[model samples]
Target: MELITNLPVLAAILATFLLAGLVKGVIGLGLPTIAMGLLGMVIAPAEAAALLVLPSLVTNIWQLMDGPKLGPLLRRLAPMQVAVAVGTLLGLWAGLLPGKGGATAGLGAALLAYAAFGLLPLRLPQVPPRAEAWAGPLVGLLTGLVTAATGVFVLPAVPYLQALGLERDRLVQALGISFTVSTLGLAAGLASGGGFGGGALGGSVLALLPALAGMALGGRLRGLVSASTFRRCFFLGLLILGAHLLWQGLH
Candidate 1:
């Protein structure tokens, strides 16, 4: 729309989507994390988030559709479902807070930092039952908060999942399900907060094309890339994005 018609901004959005899609296609996750980071630089964090919702839905839906072995996926993640939901709600509430520009940037910075550290591939020993009990709620809370604030919920969970050595299929399924649930929650929360007006909603729809194009290309190129390579690219991209965010915030 007119809001994003600036040639430079349009190019940046498309380029962000193209790279984000490729990352997701090859690695099973990273669409929001990458796209939001780049787009956030070009626009408000909320606008970046608005831009991401449809694409996140589209890409995750595609992932959920193709993913098999649902039973195992559910079983492995069952313990945390409630936590995810709860965390998502909390995040929604957080999003509704006033003076959100600073909060959104702060949340984005935290997410970027988490993703950056996760690049080191840290792992905890077999998690204790009590830890597992608490982990879900904590991660869910952070995920939801991130969703509400910046339209991204990959933090903490994405890295934790990777650390757990999840197979590609399970990783994709888990993220897809999580994103779907949380995004719906976010949509509801944003609607309640009077966040998605006519122009923003229109922009959100327009943003979906780049997201879809990115994911489609990623899907096609999936076989050509190694997981580690993709992960490295994702992590490094986050590092750059995170630094950029911090610089933007400081200035």
Candidate 2:
């Protein structure tokens, strides 16, 4: 891929992934969000998505395995995951995945919404235990559509998960599980669309190195920083990036 061959682009990719991984390490999320928001500026959204697959998949898998409640979580979330896969493939077949021009605007909108959710004092209604049967699938389906369009899947899904009233550790693990599935769904969609060829796959693998390193560093720094303060700054950054992309797309 040109991204790998071009020194400047490669450097940007490495640095972007490193920063993204650091965020994920400290906060337990944001790898795909940060990577997509930054890399989307330098590359096509599809190419950015392709480059994101491996690092996201690997890191999320690590997160998923860290908790002891995997079995229970999977049993609770299985339906949602199935819907995520189905919705992603359906979105691909429907050609909802962004192409050149429209994709930028769509990605920008997704990022803006996600950032706003984080920055706002929004309180979603708690999900009653009985509601999971339907709510889970609905949220998953919407998340898959967003993932297909923007390669970032933290909209209704994140909110929905939060509403489920899981314990802190369980919630984190659930997020990992959901994100892992979303990444796989996205990978399949990209591959079917011919966006995940060997070059893109190779670039993604290469990107993993810096991402992992950044995660290690972020893990070490987590103890020294106030998470709430860092989170505020992170959302603010996303807000600016999202606005820029939105403006660029509109023009």
Candidate 3:
């Protein structure tokens, strides 16, 4: 409540969510990516991540629930999720937000990688069933490390899921499942670090309204636009943002 009364912080929170939700609604991903990348510019990465907890969890749950075959998907993804949870805790213990410079630099490098992948057509080799046990844990560990440091988890997680040879819809649902677990794991990490102060908690809850509203608008917009082209523009913008974060961190 007190923080919301501060116009600048409130405005930043609103804009962050509106844009994040719009991205997710259109592309079915990037909510946390945008929120952390943009919000961390104005606030601490830990606080930015903390503010994402509720909305990210809720929206991803919505995504996870849409597909009917959650049971099989859940079973297949269990090891990955467990590894993510454990790895997130370990990464946090290792210094979740290291320092402003270090965190921003790490995030910048990650965003650069993410943006580059966005431009390329990534064709991952299929993971054989026999390899999933080892492969899944490796990807989960990487995702958790990124989430702990950068507040983004798309790197190995999404690409790994993409390589699993699942159908399109199943891939979407699997991403949702992974994101949901990441959100919860992130929340736990933030709580452990005392990032969930009153203002941060309130900002997270209040940001949900704009997030939902933007999602609704974006959903409507999806029908009227070419999403593939839109995604290209989104990636370009992310590239610029990544460059800025890198500059800020290095300087």
Candidate 4:
């Protein structure tokens, strides 16, 4: 309590998590992306990454278990999952370079890329099954590297999953599988970098409460709210937030 009593930071962290969890509850994605993007405004991307470790892991694990097909999903995604972990370690190596603004700038660039991808609605041509054999691992690698660097893991990964031609429900479950693996990889990356030596654990735990509450609220709203409308609002909001983070990081 004493540590988080500092009003500004605590308020910011809690608000970020609540908002993020609401987005996830409604759209089934964007927890880390929203949390990290918003938190980066008040803290470094690295510290924000550290703070998200626990909540991301917990939420993703819940999602991963919600379906009965976990065994097949795990087996199918094994290559991509392994590549993601490797890429995360590689990105952590780059994140270790001593610099003033590089990590922030990198995070900003990632935000810009993500925002652009979202706003434009660009859909890649679906890859043939043979291609996925290679493309899956490649996309996972890129997603993992980005996750390690900016604490946001959506980039090529989400788009890649979308292109998989799975049914809607299966797609959602696939996201859970990908996110669960990615969260674990992120924890390892941050741990290796000494990002959790201080009060990050307490902060993350405190933030989790609001996140879960917001998810419950958003879950209820899902029946009442138009998802497409909410998604439009969400992405537009992310566009604005991403722009702000980019500006802050560079200037």
Q: Residue by residue across 1-251, what tens digits does model 1's lDDT show?
A: 45477889878877888787777777777787777777776676666666666777777778877778777766666656556666656766655431265654565586567666758756655455556666766776666666666666676666555545567677778888777766666666666676666766776777778777877887788778776787776677677777777677766
Clashing residue pairs in candidate 2 (N, C-alpha, C atoms within 3 angstroms)? none
Give candidates' CA RMSD values in order: 2.8, 1.1, 1.6, 2.2
In model 2, the Cα lDDT at residue 147 comes to: 82
Q: TM-score each candidate.
A: 0.84, 0.97, 0.94, 0.92
Model 3 segments beyond 4 Å from truth? 1-3, 98-101
- Using lDDT, give the best candidate's number: 2
How high a TM-score does candidate 2 get? 0.97
Better of 1 and 2 by TM-score: 2
| Model 4 CA deviation exceeding 4 Å by range | 1-3, 96-100
Instruction: Give me the displacement of residue 210 in model 4, in angstroms.
Output: 1.2
Give the lDDT of residue 160 in candidate 1. 58
Q: Score each candidate by Cα lDDT.
A: 0.69, 0.88, 0.84, 0.77
Off by over 4 Å in 1: 75-79, 94-101, 104-108, 128-131, 163-165
lDDT of 4 at 102: 59
Q: On residues 101-159, what C-alpha lDDT tens digit does candidate 4 reach at each position?
A: 45566666776676677668687777788887899899999988777767777877888
Error of 2 at 110 (Å): 1.3
Q: Which of 1 and 2 is ahead in lDDT?
A: 2
After aligning candidate 3 to the native by TM-score, how far in Å is the CA of 15 from where it should be? 1.3
